[model samples]
Target: MRIPVKHPWTLPKRLLGTFVILASIGRIQSEQKSSKQPNIVVIVADDLGWNDVSFHGADQIPTPNIDALAYNGVILNRHYVLPTCTPSRTAFFTGRYPIRTGMQGKPLSVGEPRGIPLNVRLLPEHLRNLGYRTRLVGKWHVGYYTNEHTPTRRGFESFYGHYSGYISYFNYTISKNNHTGFDLHQDTASTLEMRRNSNYATDVFTEEAVKVIENHDATEPLYLHLAHPAPHSSEAKEVVEVRNMSEVNSRFGYIENINRRKFAGMMMALDQSVGRIVKALGDANMLDNSIIVFMADNGAQTEGFLENYGSNYPLRGLKFTHYDGGVRGVACIYSPLIKNNSRVSEQLLHVTDWLPTFYSLAGGDVNDLGDIDGLDQWSAISLAENSARESLLINIDDAVNLRGVVSGKFKLIEGAADLYGNYYGDTGNNNSYPEYNITEILESDAGLAITSIGNSLLTETKILNLRSASIVRCNNFTDFANCSDTCLFNLQNDPCETTDVSADYPEIFISLSKMIEIFESELVPQTNTDVDPASYPEKFNGFWMPWVASDSSTIIATSSLIGLINILLHIFSLIFFS
Candidate 1:
């Protein structure tokens, strides 16, 4: 101690040097992270089915572009989502369980005066804070009752999509409560030009996405949320609009069901859209530094509300039920950064994970997201590490008294007996489905782009391995013959949820039941309000818009006064400087 006191200046200098070295290391790390920030592109397919993409062993449909990406990327075999669109999207955007936001019920109707609460920051907002340019194209069914609820207000710099749950592909019309109106908009303003042009929504969204990529300042990271309206039937639940009917008829002639045939065509456009998006990224020189996440918002609506004629064949239940078919989605991630490629990941994941996952990937701390249901799964996803998730709160719909939870390999569901809790299967064998020319698809503009940046060549063996690993076979257990209200199933043994194991595994069932009770205690009351007539699109130029109005005239007056003051200040500055 006496020796150090005799050399006080030297000790202080040593401490200062240490501090500088630490700061330098931190700065270097920050710079390295900043340089490695990948452009994030999340492509969400609306109402796509589990057995829809060819990679998932479906012969009825050929998603070549989608398959190319899946084969080149990691297929998320056990990716789970909420049962329907809004709830799934809410989880994706908010990083919280829908139950926390009181959005665990049905999709938001046209005029509900509620949305993902504004106080809670959204994914785009967090990304924007980290210097990413965020844009949204396609469906924005989260909320739009107030001016503050739209995408642009929430964080998206540009919003080119519909505000309602679903809209017509060509006409951009949405109908609800016997009121039909235009639903397309370009950041709060009705995209009347698009309506007049009558472009297919998928094609339109693709073009806009391409434009966003092409026109982007590449120095800045991009977060493009391409939420397609394809395959999600229009509100009419009968219309399936595609760019070319002749091509649809020729390409999907083998499909027996007419509705499914239309859906196939719709999916064709969506697949092509994916191709073009990949091509655009390549053209823009962003593919090598990009992460493309392709996922269906939820399982298909094969026969329920907004029935798109999509099939979740070989899985139990459809969109609104608690079964795997309802929540298990078709999802995959393609990126040059993924250390694990051309494989199937059995690790359990949920829709809510995207927020923290993407945020972490963008070099932000997941802890900043704070107490959300989502776990930072970036490492688990990219490095093939085990997922941080131990369990999934599939949903807790208090309004319907339905609750579901998945822990380990067992899943428990209560209040879903009357729902479509039956296993469904397609006749096509997983081992033997109609094969496409891999060379032809892999050589296409999109295929080449995706393959160049992803796992080298898409060989037959790789394709076979991907298919073999991802194929869900329900040969042994064909159906959930009679599921009780509180049914439990070992999903690992019976992925299709064929047998109710609640009585057999009483301990596991009771443990999951208790977990559900704990979640139920934290349930936020569902804010299901009746349609506010004032929000009718008829009042605001035939577009589904923010009808709450929010004192526009007062805002305009204040803005004008502020502009006048700014001009005066500028004049004064000029005089003073001169």
Candidate 2:
């Protein structure tokens, strides 16, 4: 059967031109929704190492999905984050250094009243103002002392995850100071009964993220922050949790260390989660109009309390120290909008930059975010321009007597950082797995972007080019053994702070030290309070909850009702069994 068509000769030329104009206008209207505000998906991996991902030249455990994303995007070579989770998150959310908000201290402890200061606005709140539906899944470690500090109150429309730093993979429980409590929740309500058997935290978060993406309204832009807790150790005594023992044994048989093997499995789970989330976006037809940003919160805890045995490899120092290993994180940005893709960017980008950067990307005025430490670098990232950021105030904690600042290529450090400052991991380029082709990953839906950019298929040559451009190969300097206070190292020459060049370059040292002094002047005194016994989980029916906030009444009422039922059950047990 021949398909009937409107004959061109049937209408006048002017009328036909009018019809063409109308059709073009209709097409423009249909595409305007996505073109106006693209969906923003920021996936944060907790405590991931600099050398852990395969893109960074690690081969022991393959992260094909992550590598595919990186290869299709710009691999951030000099991306700097804080040395720990809480501070890093504070910077990312607020687009300001932690020092400005008194969040410069350690991670928010259990029952601590301190949070990203209530006065300081967050990224989600700004995105929300731009008519974006904001949702957070997985870790909310910045703060949860009060109802106002929680994700829902802090700009996210919905929250589905734990309130604390880390929780058990299966049970969703956190242990601190010999006290155990259920931390999993679905927007201020404890998800105790909703917990699925054998459902790991990483998998659960991934499912929730995919659901959010699938169910999201296409008209309204979505800002989904999927913060995965995998690779970050749980609060329990058995820190690392590996759901698939069989796969761990088979895939990571080369790794002799038990914790490292477990870490590899956790990474595998996270990589799978990344793949699934991207697939969900593609399945929903949101890929072309979406931007995916993947980054580790901070560096890995190589060997310490709550260590997952992650490797920073050639980079010196562990999670708590101010070294490239701890601060220089794994990061990338993948989107069709980006002109510069499938390359490594050596631009200096700080965690705080994301706030203004993302806001500008969402078509918001940077002036609205007044006096923020984060500089907008959307142009620098997307167009491969020189970064707006020239220097980075690494950190300053007077309590610990530690301070660090990076100016140009020179980095200045003071206080005791030598304890964990040593090269880690022997498996740098041991077993390179280049078999996971970026073009073959149909789930990620990044191949089209790669091929569209002048027929680049993310080939082996391009992968090597990207990896070589990003990976920091240290010179293994064996100079003056003294690594005490007031140390200086040129990060350009010594990416690993193996040698102290402070005495050699006095002017640069003085300049960076003065830079620290300037940042210190803006520091807010730490407001972290002692753990309030009233905030204990036992008081709230074995669940971590807000205590001193106005919204505590609802939880209190629920706890009272459950307590009454428990007492009634005890009385019945005495009457029956006794």
Candidate 3:
């Protein structure tokens, strides 16, 4: 290849060097453009226990995908939400207290018209205004029975899935068809039906989710809400494919063998769903730019028919109770933006925080939205910083009577009458005489049946008495006098809620009680003004909707200006350097 060496011009060599430098600059500018916006995906699991995932010490189930997320991102150890599904979801959606939005207790059945207020802007609505294509796949339980509460009405551009409290995993049902049963829907169109087969519900939800990801527009950033309803029902199919077999037997003694197996199966399917979503995003080359959030709506189901199988042990109480087990949940955020993969304890975050956090991460205007009760934790995500709220107040009752306040490690649970009315010897009929003498029964009980009955009664009484003693005057509102015990505990030392430190720390108890009183007095409505008029048909807005700003023009203008500057700089640099 020894060819003739003509005095090849130094001008060409200089031009080549300039081209190389210009290409390098252009590549850097492209990298900057990609970093401006990131995709977001929030995966919400229904009724998953704190210990159910492998990262949280569930040996009986192999949630490797979920564990991988924790290994790569921040695992929040002190994440909390309301005790039930609807309240937690409402908070997550609106960044406001569930009580503030008037969605408490169980979510409304399908066709019910209640929804997040028009005045309160939802997370997706704000994100959508900022130019994100929002989609919700899976459970939309916020307002199932009402058209006003549908996903499209709540800010989602497209909605897929059912509208009901609970549907069969094999034979899923929709509330729109009177709950008898119908195929899942995408908007108003029927998608699929498992009429004669037992296809797992989680599988169906996951499959549809992948489709949504696959079909998403590549140019516009995507915000997908995959709210899976699985591992939540009493009859949910359990997977028995665990590394540790004995762990299942020891941990889930209350659930029957069959149900436990079914639960395990459901969990396995859920793990697979997570894996699938991750794999799909990776295949699409979107994994590095996407933020994946995994969280349960609340603690495991602790009552009704599913009590035995769903245990929140090591944490007292269950789904409906205002206890750690009911409110505390497993939460984690996976993002390339987060540099460290470690457990974040001490930070007290709630469901409401998701809205502002996601908004800030997506580059949305936080202040343009209405009043929100959450703080943006984007700084905490990128850096190992503690960004949490000062306090979390829970109003489990409409009257603000049954409530709890958690500040730091101190949790003040207001002792109110057991709404379940599980008091021993007190027949639900107040007129009936007490069936058994409380003293004689406690002394005589030794067998499993007697011990169980006695323990139940004692627990109920303790909760009742604690409520009564804490209040100076017992109003029939919460029926504090009917409760057997009122108590306070330093949750820091007693995470299990075993020891009552109320007597030892009377001052702490008094302070918490006074705080509760102040919160109740300020927030709880003394008159009918608290009642939401939207619940009534007469208060309909007559098709009125918010004036959503069209941001595409601004986005196009900004992007075009950036591209033009990059191009012009490259051209000028090449010409001058050459």
Candidate 4:
């Protein structure tokens, strides 16, 4: 009987194993139970430069509220986007390249009616399908040329903003459209004329945004897209104030001093809008659960009066160029999931990344959204991984096709052309002469010499000799062969694009050129609805008759008669001299 009584060590060991199993089961259950879905809000600014924000080292502007987000969240040092509005917006919405979405050219004008194609599914639509409420407030430039691409048809349950790209801050009338009227909408119904002389659009947009947030149901997760069209082109009121300065004397000069002041003011207004949105979320007790993102659509346009006020500084080129100044921008993301508040310098993310990133945050299967070019950058931002995107492609204007490829520290840009040349005829055949190699010119002290050559050619052949030569003849230059290979520069040392380094790095030139061809082949040419004007109600087939005013004499005579009547009436009333 004593021999049969075994020691109790085995019993204790069995008890320890049971306890360890229970602890493991408890840990697994806790992790599964604690998983949560987060809300998302994306605030985008149009044509804002890298130095525009205070957090990114701007002393002229104060963006305390925006800086707070950067301070709290991960500040992305090398984020890239398209050089124009439509392309950027399309990329963000569809999670595909702009060229893939068939938005590769200049923005669809007010006259041209085209929208997001039916085949493509937007981010909001996918989020909505997953039981999230999506709302879009601000400028929707993806489609206005047609009804099919409207926000309602895309995926958003609610839309509040203008269809055309730009509107008068005071009157809400688009200047190019001759003050033709349009109304802002909420869902299917038009809510207001979107025109106000006393109230600024920036302020009004913020107010409407707050209202939208307040109206959203707390139980349902919300995705709010706040797109601000401020700090793009300076408003007339702000322009007048800065144009009087001696440094900005020319109203028509490139990058005028007044433009900067006005742009600063507009940026301030946008910052205030951000403050309002954040405050609204806090007021609703939704801050902790919401993922907030703030970024710019593209680079600043320094042409005309803008250059006198805003400077891309170390970055070469402007909004229309493919240089770092045009594509590189400030991007920040704030979320509870981000463990530390540090700058993320590794990942080279793009606008398309948002779709998959948001889907993962919302606790949905990202693969369910189907094919997309953007990768999920969450792991990179969370410090779980260290990697960057290999290449990012962007198209600025219709005439400029640019491909930027970054490998480690070496960045190469190919097929750089000037869209301004199409307007001025300096480059001759916007298609033929590639004008300048940005990397080459910015690397050397002879940067000015290169620019001077192009400037002199532009002045002599295009601007000064405009009346003598036809548009075709003015832009037809056969001298591209002489300088085509001479314009390349090393961007790492010369970010300002001042020198030509093609002589030393011949391999880079060939690699970048090949990359450019590959990129171009993938692009599906966007149907230019602006060409061959067509009236509404007609289904656009990429072809329309050229716009020609019928009965020109009646229109001219009526205008002349009205002018003559006003003069005669003034003369009779003795008001002309007064």
Candidate No. with top TM-score: 1
Per-residue lDDT tens digits for candidate 1, residues 106-139, read: 8889888889876667898777756579999989
- Candidate 4 overall Cα lDDT vs. reference? 0.58
Off by over 4 Å in 2: 1-35, 196-198, 431-456, 477-481, 551-578
Candidate number of the best lDDT: 1
Superposed Cα deviation of residue 170, candidate 2 (Å): 0.9
Give stretches of model 4 more than 4 Å off: 1-35, 177-179, 191-198, 234-256, 305-309, 344-346, 396-398, 418-494, 531-578
Ranking by lDDT: 1, 2, 3, 4
lDDT of 3 by residue, 257-332 (tens): 4555446666767877887787677656667677889998877764563342444544555676676767788788
Residue 494 of model 3, lDDT score = 62
TM-score of each: 0.88, 0.86, 0.69, 0.69
Q: In order, what is each prediction's RMSD in angstroms?
A: 10.2, 14.6, 16.4, 22.6
Clashes of each: 1, 0, 31, 32
lDDT of 2 by residue, 491-569 (tens): 8888878788888999888888788888888888877677777888888888888877554445444433443343333
What's model 1's lDDT at 377? Answer: 84
Candidate order, TM-score descending: 1, 2, 4, 3
Question: Which scores better on TM-score, 3 or 4?
Answer: 4
User: Any idea what lDDT model 2 has?
Assistant: 0.79
Query: In model 2, what are the clashing residue pairs, if there are any?
Result: none
